[model samples]
Target: MSTDKGQYFNDLRTIQANLPTEYSRTFGQMIVHYYLHLIKSSHTQKANAKGLKQQAAGILQEFKRKQSLRKDYPATDLLVWVAESNHLPQALPVTSLLKEKKYRVTYISNKQQLLANPALEGYNKIQVVLPKRGIIAEKQVKEFEAVVSSIIANTNLAIITAEDIDTISKAFREYVTYTRQLQADYEKVITNVNPKAALIGYDIPTEGRTLTDVLNAKSIPTFMIQHGAMAKVDGIFGTHISKTIFVYGEVSKQVLKDSGTKADIKITGAPYLDELMKKLHTAGSKAQGKLKVLVAFSGPGHLTTENHHKKSIEAVMEVAKNHSGSVEFYFKLHPKDNRSYYTAEMEGKNLTNVHFKLPHSQSNDIFDWALFADIMLTGASTVAIEAMLCRKPVISLDLTGDYKELSFVKEGAVKLISDKAELNTVIEQAVLQNFDAFDASSRKAELYAKQFYGPTDGQAAQRCAQLIEPSLN
Candidate 1:
């Protein structure tokens, strides 16, 4: 098991060196990271001991051998994703592979069709209908409860929560209700499924929350998969307490030291970015003409506190109005945001130069657009990391206060734009800047990402799979 664990991580070293530079540590957070990493490592040690005793090494090796030989063997179950539309695209490759590996696939949408879309053949989907009259919170919990009951009975639970803690953008207090409901619903689902092994995509940003309360309370062996640059969010301390944490590069392993998170942190490069890189390369040569810029706004979170969606839309609209034909702006809305927000700002205006993109578009489709864009704009979306992976320039706009905590912004991979006027000037300069030779700072940042993310070779998922299979009993 130890040898398997070591081998799993060794594959990730190359990936770490390839991480983007924009994912650097900010001041004051290093100490906390180190301490947290230490704690997490200790927890992993304990979990490993249990696995070692429960399943012997000989059987584990045999399982691997069987996995190799039985490529055509059908998986016993399927993973059903009933998530929002934006998040759905990210899971596509995973779902696709699961099917190829012989596992059935199912995807659920929050709205629209009830009988599941035909395009998702062999994949099952259920529409989430809410009670029309009740409070939104009550409706969500009740609806989730029904789904949880059905899923737990039919399939092995494949839990995927980007982060355990949900934030409220309005008043800090408003977060309490959503947070509580999420916790309650998640707990109910996990309890019913009684998952044998679970995967955590990233470290949980836990400050006051307890891992045992959110997870582990039921003793589920969670396998953590590092989703992006090794940036820490709140409740990360709790992540240190997870049974095991998987990472992609050495830089991320080092980041745990700074964030004070200690898990048995293993390098498993992110599959999402890996696939993106592959698609970019296969698309043929890089851009030849005017740099296309895609501007994305991640809404209603720590950065856009107090429903600044209007302000954000106004800011983008102002840019569209000003730049119209000079610079083509592709606006990608956050999955969580309502389309009404975009319609409210863009409806009657009839702006042809600007395209406002919604969720559900293939991630690759969007990436295809982003690849040609000379520059990119965003308000704290991890898409910045994607931009770096694509070798495109990016700017992050922070309307609210939490920009400092963002790793890429701190590393200067992204420029901070606080207001509409400042954003306008920065966008103009970035788009017009000649790329005859990539900027030195930009090159340096890319080198930094190599360390932060691992390899740019585009096999993050394969690397992650090797890292995980060994550890699972």
Candidate 2:
């Protein structure tokens, strides 16, 4: 359990590189992206290894279960969509536009639960297809198992299995077979459709990358749309693999450009942002409240390594207890976040004006609260950028001081504060509209919004569609 992150990441890469050649060539590319989220507050260096072993087992079991259930895909030329829930909003408008232009499109949702999500209601009709005639061959699984066992026995990768090697020796074996089978599913799907061009949102996720890599390997064009703002991280996130990556505007284009990315980065105004701006500009001013403050949580695992996720809420609510009548604080949880924990925390406090924004039925959801809030607080989340697009003042509690790469903060569109005192002072000023601070900040936010989101004419989806239409030719 070392604090040396450099050593930890190095060991991670070594384990990934040592994966069975077949998988290392495919799934290994994004293993770090997955592991970065796994190393939450409840992890240690030992726990990290144990977690990977368990993850491997789960994957293998899932694939083995699927061996009995195989289906064939539709045989036809098509347009493929690999957008998950997070990517749905950015994808829906553009996909809709393409369909309107008479293109054959099918959305292959990765998660079954997404079927119930309100966003996909009308766009849910999909091409239920598969080219494979049968389930996983027994020989494929056994061969992978043998290769992994042989490699683990022959290699120097104690870093991956050191914590509980004997108990989970089959872990690596399962992992290798799972990736192989997973890749084939994507390949078979692509073979069935022979897609004109496949589109996947911000392609660092292993599942998305697997699908796109399969397409890329087949020489089928692929597009990785800008799902959110860029963050500063080691290669754990935002490594593009698609034939082209569509960014929102100049700022994100520059961020990816400076990252030394090999993929072509093009400026395409965000599809979701276009709709939000349409709603925002047509909507009136924020509703009446004393000092309307929205504190949004970016979930517990991603950037909350030291438990800053919980503490930030404590800091905000702790201070809110002081000015009961003058200010109201709204707590907005990320869609995947637990509601019970925050509900309990606010239960017996007897605090006034503290409320939780429940999930919205609208596709992108948080636009209502983002519009309602006069000021916002968060840590290294794209929510800050969305709030900036709404021209709301944003404050981030950089408790660790390592979030300097947060885009809005870097551009001076958001205020960066270190602790509770500053949070209180900023909230007070934001409430009083001290010397046109709100007006001045609003103007600054809009100027930068043009840079962050490009044209507000609501033509982003058209622009994106035009760029993607060429691949069909």
Candidate 3:
């Protein structure tokens, strides 16, 4: 990478390091949802309460729509809140994927606008606004606290640690900013616990704070999740969470020991990834047509701290030109990002071999495309991990920033790069390589699942449900 590019990547990492804990990512989402609701309700380009009320109304409609599903299954009163991803396959597909495995699922989050429209009425789902039995408010700290406190009065909390605080802080604003307040509240909850443990999804939310202080405050067992596959540079991976941290792989466990987290950790794999692994096993259905590779365009506000997304896209375009005839390359720009962002670089050039996917294309369709593709390409993403599990070869180019330092991509598991030249070569290799050649990597993906999670039998939701079944009953 050139000096300028190197500096850019360095700056990106610095911003990532400063990101609020992952818990904060949800808060950012809420703010986005709040504003978006405001925008759509007014039907005007202006921002005001009218628009916000419209957004809230839309969410309420979606909640009622989802709630309608339970009308027939009265015995199933417990609300299952699956996180809604506006990016990859919305919450419906997630719940559908879970249902396929015989687990009943529901929608519970702020992004309920997607489900409110008449177009989604074909699907039977119930959404609860308030005064409902369950709330899937992942980052809605105030509401989440109230609900958890009511149900799990004996609930314990934990915080997973990494170098990124800004990202987490932005997502879980109320929880992190009001740490002392939350800590005091949690103390009251931990007073009643004996055998039950509440696993807080602390995916890299603890950074600047001392792990020991947080862990000690909650005498209740506080558990954490290993963010990704481990490698050298994951400073003190297992040492930060309570004595019982949940890791994805043995490498992560070893890295934790190397970092000095002496907590007795368990390998719960990744609860977040359980849905993806299920897709991999059932993808034997041969998919026809072009082997597609999707490049998700994320802006500086989300995913990247630096404005290198266009540069990365240009590099992929350069490589796509090489095999455009046989292999297909698609770009899914972030909802917030637009084509104008790349006006200078892609203005005159029209690469017939490449295509740009608008936000209308659901993330689930992309995942389905990933299933049929000969290989998948990305800059730096957890999506690469999912691609690997789907048995597709992955080529992760380090277009900019501290991508080389990420624990998951650092391993040879993902192909990293700095510019168009390197990405071109990686893409060429990925497209031509035989699928069978990746059996070992796929198995490693499975092992990554088992070591961290305990099973890959497509029953992760069922397994998770098993843990919470008695509570619901």
Candidate 4:
């Protein structure tokens, strides 16, 4: 299994260097993000390339499609906060708390559907940034296409063929056009809103970069919020253009530092975790029926194979099937995961107590699952950290043996397990015992968790608000 990008990343970096400085800053770097996701979960080059060509063809089609719109943003004086993936639950309390501080925050989302979320209901101004629009300027295609060919031809990739470069180059041109449209739309937003300052999600994502670039040129300081922990290949980390990045804790801050991050990092805690912190301090009594077990699905690609992810779920379901009388299982999917495929798997099973939770912007989040379950089961997802922070026991299920030792596990905040039989045993014992039986383990988990993301006083959002409030005036 290919644990690291190895030669492929070297090849891509070579391409990044080949592109002219102008395009290299945005589009060239975007090329890297595209491939990072492409093979992010695939542990082997064989698995990674299984459908890569077809995927590339599809991406070309998507690039050539109309995905954004041109809009005349109205004039305003609000401080614009652009969150593509970091909407509602993730940006929580920080956005709301800032509003309370009298910062008229205009929330912009790239996911068009997020504006309707009930969690964002009380917000005064919320809008969606259309993801893409029809191709804009065809004016400068040949020159960039030549640059694309030069970059592709010179780079020796572990995946993709010389023949693939032709299709890929065309897509690159389309992306250039799409990115140009994004630049135009954002410029319009700037001209109309005259944003006070800016706050964005990740430093990656061409969309976020376009916004940051436009905002930066206007001397608007942009702050990025850290929603998840950083892994080595999560993306290009050191290349941030934001003035500063707001992180969850020192652990994340240190990781960013090691990755050569240039931006100043402020540990503001995690707003979602802060909510869990409040509930952790005064958790209501557990219902007296079956033992509640929550299975938080995360990192099928980054941590395990898609097949192994399925195996982990099957293991949980089997344990539930065997202990139906004593235990209930809740499967919480990552927002990017599809529920329909899993829905079909549960169709014929008589596992009546098995529950499925589809988490959206405003719906039940991982914290709610952590709070409601007696024991949490995951594959070392970031949720394991969040669940532990909520004072819940977390078991990391490893199927392909591709597990890495994260700090939390070394700190004993999470336990890594592989045997399915052992999973059944844990469920049976916990269900047969008192609800408080796992209380000691839960408390122990919290001790390590505090070191990971602590001060569980539930003020992470407040801390972020305090930092951003000063720049408003």
Off by over 4 Å in 4: 5-14, 36-78, 82-86, 90-92, 117-174, 231-240, 273-276, 284-288, 299-301, 357-363, 434-444
Model 1 accuracy (lDDT, Cα): 0.49
Per-residue accuracy of model 4 over 116-182 as CA lDDT, tens digit each: 6677775645354443324535556667667767767666665554555544455554466567666
Prediction 1 TM-score vs. true: 0.58
CA lDDT scores, all candidates in order: 0.49, 0.63, 0.45, 0.64
The whole-model C-alpha lDDT of candidate 3 against the native structure comes to 0.45
Compared with the true structure, what per-residue lDDT tens digits does model 1 show for residues 300-333?
A: 5324443555777778788777777676677776
lDDT leaderboard ranking: 4, 2, 1, 3
Residue 458 of model 3, lDDT score: 48
TM-score of structure candidate 3: 0.51
Q: Positional deviation of 335 in candidate 4, in angstroms? A: 1.6
Clashes of each: 55, 4, 39, 5
For model 1, the stretches where C-alpha displacement exceeds 4 angstroms are 1-195, 200-215, 227-242, 250-257, 260-262, 282-291, 307-309, 347-350, 358-364, 399-401, 430-441, 470-473
Q: Each model's TM-score, in the order given?
A: 0.58, 0.78, 0.51, 0.78
Candidate achieving higher TM-score, 1 or 3: 1
TM-score of candidate 2 on Cα atoms, chains taken together? 0.78
Q: Write the per-residue lDDT of candidate 3 for residues 388-408, one digit (tens) a residue.
A: 666566666666554665555
| Cα lDDT of model 2 by residue, 218-272, tens digit | 8888887776666443333335668888877887777766654567888888887
Q: Output the number of the lDDT-best candidate.
A: 4
